[model samples]
Every structure is written in C-alpha cells, then in structure tokens.
Target: YKETLSGPTRLISIDGADHTFGSIPWQEELFSNTLEFILANLS
Candidate 1:
C-alpha cells in the first residue's frame, strides 16, 4: 500500500490467501468486510 517501496501497488495485510471471495474456501464474508472499507471511506 506504500508507493515508496519498490514494488507493484499492493493491498496490505491480505496476501497469500488461499480462500477469498471466489476461492475454494469461499470467504465471501471476509471479502465483503474488506471491500466495505473501500465503500465506507469513499462514501
């Protein structure tokens, strides 16, 4: 999430996830919560 670091634009904390919204474990709730941050801040 930092531009100063030399790497692609990254979303912090959520990485190496084997189970996301559409993944095998199907963590839609986690994804929804994470996504709500965007909506709340933006709104």
Candidate 2:
C-alpha cells in the first residue's frame, strides 16, 4: 500500500502506545515527532 506514495514518507512506532495514544508521554512523543516532520518538510 505504501508503494504508491510520491514524496517523503515516514513510519513511527511508539512503545506501549495504543491506537488512541492513551498516555500522556506517548501523546507528547507523537505530537513532537509530528511537529518535527512538518517543520522539516516546510519550504
């Protein structure tokens, strides 16, 4: 399924994180990584 993507792609897995990111630390990590990715891709 991922083979059809056209640009930069990433996969992040957080230990002990459920589908909803039910923990504070896991949520923080998810948000932090997402923000970093967005910033890096900005022109």
Judging by lDDT against the true structure, name the best candidate: 2
lDDT of 2 by residue, 1-43 (tens): 3331223332343332345455557656755687577779894
lDDT of 1 by residue, 1-43 (tens): 2241222222343464423424644444645565676668778
> Residue 5 CA error for candidate 2 (Å)?
20
**Native RMSD of candidate 2 (Å):** 7.6
Residue 3 in model 1: lDDT: 42
Best by TM-score: 2
State candidate 1's TM-score: 0.37
lDDT, residue 33, candidate 2? 80
Determine the backbone clash count of candidate 1.
Answer: 0
User: 28 in model 2: Cα distance from truth in Å?
Assistant: 0.3
Provide the overall lDDT of each model, using Cα atoms, as 2-decimal numbers. Answer: 0.45, 0.50
Give all TM-scores, in the order shown: 0.37, 0.44
Clashes of each: 0, 0
Question: What does the lDDT come to for candidate 2?
Answer: 0.50
